[model samples]
Target: MAGTKTIDADVAIVGCGVAGLYCALNLPHALRVVLLAKTTVDECDSMLAQGGICVLHDPDDYESFFEDTLRAGHYENRLESVDMMIRASRPIIDDLIKRGVRFARTATGELDYTREGAHSRPRIVYHEDITGEEITTHLLACVRELPNATVFENTCMTDILEGFDADGRRVCRGIVAEDAGGAHLQVNADATVLATGGVGGLYKHSTNYPCLTGDGCRVAAEHGVLLEHMDFVQIHPTTLWTQKPGRSFLISESARGEGAILLNDAHERFCDELQPRDVVSGNILREMRREGAEHVWLSFERVPREELEHHFTHICEQCREEGYDIFSEPIPVVPAQHYFMGGIHVNSDSETTLPHLFAAGETCCNGVHGRNRLASNSLLEGLVFAQRAADKIMRDRFAADTAAQLAVAASERSRFVAGSRDVTDVALLCGAE
Candidate 1:
């Protein structure tokens, strides 16, 4: 048995992925922040997102992007949340760039945009095929440099510590966690944020980190926190197929967006490669069932070899290591559990029903992605809502601090008046004497 440990912070952020890191980053340096990671800080599913993050690009791109998202989500998305995410997209991307994210650029040095499935236009920005890694790593680096932030790796959040606030409202006191050495950890904080990624680890095969088993949602559920769309999981249309599986390697949807196509056993195109993920995945599954095939093929023959070498270096190297030469042959692909659209229910401000508790990323359902997620929207949504959660926390904390200061000032004023009266009365007594 190991000893118990307790720590305190102004804010405790669970999961050190993009959401957690960004949340911590957006917080002021005066506030103490504690970040917990299930494994290494870089092990979250956000690091595996190969496609670029979506952006609104320009003013004219708004309506089309909005409509495309609605259509992809089957109108199950909350309009306000969708609008918030889309409207915030440009600023979020700018923030990433300011944080030293090296997105792909054109010859003229302007940001290069690419199209993805379900997008009405080319609105996604990338750093080759590993955009997630690029963005997440940079954000992680920034968080690491913060003087008020502390990071705990190899720590798993077993559950959230619950209690009642001064007002008798249910609130979270932070989390009860277990570290790599089996030590019990109790992190008490004024605010607790759950950014524990997604639930793909529970699946037999998925394009998510095996550690991401919905810890936030599970803990929130156990504590009676409001959750939305618990069943709204999104299946990615394409991952590199393999029999010896651990984590599924996602074949970037941008591949299809660029020029790649899906072919059946008879080497005939079956599904429109540019449709929404659910539609494309369903078509691929139907094709496989019709032919009794284990997996279909993703062919990049139409994509120039130079483009492949430059844009998909990571994927190409991975395929080559797996004994498949993508340059000369089509690599096998299948659909796998990808993103979760439903999670801990949150309002537009990213506040959960429970006081002082919040969730972001794939762990929270803000209803932006609706029933099915459009390609490349996951990163944007995570970043957008994570900052919103941080902003809300800051706002509440500031208000509380201001009220406390005002109360103290009022008490001081009353005491001063009483003391002055006492002094005046003593002087009057002396005069009477």
Candidate 2:
């Protein structure tokens, strides 16, 4: 891996999802960072998130938010992780706004917050139905302007090269990557962060992007990194059921938050609309099994017609295009594989078991979300931990020593490739084996 096409950086971040983007934004400008993505930055799972970031904007809102999250996770959540996430919420939101991310606002010019199931108040800040798209676009712009940051799109990392360097101490030298053109390249760095999203694609039915095949977890596992709680996968309730089995389209939870109702084949509400996502999804599954029906229904009659027309124009139009009048009838739906509750294990500072390695977002299980995640909390987690990881790295001066090692590795690689005549295509260099 070290002798492949040589490149050097102080820090190398994998996957350009919300976590990687925010980490790049928070790192010191002097630190040379390289961000790798299998596709364009916007193609990651974060861009597909329709809900907004969750936060307790008012003091009175904390208890409900905390309880709802705990209930959703079946009380398996780590208290410290939950507290840190709650505390970091304000700063992350503030920073996002400061970085020019536009969120929906009320007519009075106040941040418009919406309430999802299991939430006691309106605490979700979004941009219509495309919250993730807005945030990613803004963060990507900020990253582009950073002098020390470089983004490699269409580059897929195959493995983390970890071993004793020339100095004979354990270290991560770099990664072997295959570019779009199938050319192999070595990206050497001092420290590496895996911000790859979830493993939803591992299941037959998933709402995640096609490329999210747990590549990060597999890479880490190959290096003997211990992963925790891999069995807890969260299936989202209310995905649009199509004739095409297992390719269910995501019907955003925001639809239910805005007053959509879930119905059974008998046209009766099957579960409490205000229950946590896991409960709702589980209940829907149970009902389907009992009735021997292929799918359930979600109706939007409770939402004001005008509000639906204004706030959910896209969904309404899509429903209409699907030959369903959402306002008048129930739309067929079923749960689909959505978020992964388990990932690379990390601590409060988002540090992985490996030294100088940090992870965040859907790729790392920081224990903030134990068995399940409350709707919209995923984005806030990414933003909060990204800053935390950046602060820890800067405080420890980890970049200085790591950057030097990376330079040396790059030099050695250049020397090795100087006389080599067999040039391999980049795309075939590395991939899921």
Candidate 3:
């Protein structure tokens, strides 16, 4: 790190996705926090999420939702994590609503829910298809209005500095970052949280934004943090294909739930629409290889054109602009990189193995989503874990004690070394928090 100016904060959070934003919003007002984002807040993958959050709103729906999630993960998920998520589902939605997020409502004035593959019931709460956008937009606004939170945009964290203190226990002291203007700065805090989103940009074709380059995983690994199941990348089953390579667009699964049919070049239904994403993507890949075709077709003719236009107006317009009438013609699609099922492993509380480091959202694998994630579960995971982390922080009061010690130590050290400064002052240099 180049710039040596020092600033104090109770906590420093990296990445401004839903988890980061929610955590900042829920943290105590007395605890000053610095929230860093590699790009603008809205540019994160959370905004691109067209699907909603999955929750067991009805008491009767819990068992079926749990079973569907376990089956989607191929039964490899940790049971405790699944139960925690299931229990947190409704509360998470209620919390978001309290934060002013407007979820889709039914004609009867009830919360509107939708069904996706592997789900047993319509339990997804959304704002039409742009649910993530609505939630993130509102939460971001709330975080900005908080006096104790400071947001840093276009700032990229290079690495986390970890070391052992007097007690010989591991600790994360601070972070080295490069701002948008290319100036390197070191930020130290009492605690650091990593909420960097997924690793979708690792693939050539992805529905994620360009900034998601596995930075969190790589940074955690460099600091000797343990990672799990890093190879289980989730490829979305339906993505709009362009003649150009590596620019596929997401065609949300809601389209299929609305009655679109996946067909091969020969006009044959190739795979089960209700299968898990991994299975569906695999089937689509096999059909493409067997039929010797570049892409498959998704036909929405069985659904009314007006209804399709009303719910999926953006997709319909894009399809029309791409020279295909979604109502009358088949829209070309293929499997594209979507979500990362594996990440820095954490427990139900969203705490990582590293001390003073917490993680949530797509960056951390909390095991609620084991081998695969059920549709609309991503947003719920973020909301649930963000709240869990906030509750843990408040209960533990780690910020207050650490910040006090750090501030006192800095004040005393400055007095001790005031008149005995040397050209090379490594002792005066403090690590990032």
Compose the digit string of candidate 3's lDDT tens values, residues 175-240: 778888888767787677889999877778899987898898899998788898998789999999
What range of 10 consecutive residues in model 3 has the weakest lDDT sum? 424-433
Best by lDDT: 1
Q: Candidate 1: minimum summed lDDT over ten consecutive residues — where? A: 424-433
- The whole-model C-alpha lDDT of candidate 2 against the native structure comes to 0.83
| Number of the candidate with higher TM-score, 1 or 3 | 1
lDDT of 1 by residue, 316-362 (tens): 99999889998899999989999899999999988898989999999
- Candidate 1 wrong stretches, greater than 4 Å: 418-433
Taking the tens digit of each residue's C-alpha lDDT, what string does model 2 give over 285-336? 9999999998999988899987677667667777788899987898999888
RMSD, model 1, all Cα superposed?
Answer: 3.6
Model 2 residue 370 CA deviation (Å) reads 0.7
**Model 3, runs deviating above 4 Å:** 163-166, 398-433
- Candidate ranking (TM-score, best to worst): 1, 3, 2
TM-scores for candidates 1 onward, in order: 0.96, 0.89, 0.90
TM-score of 2: 0.89
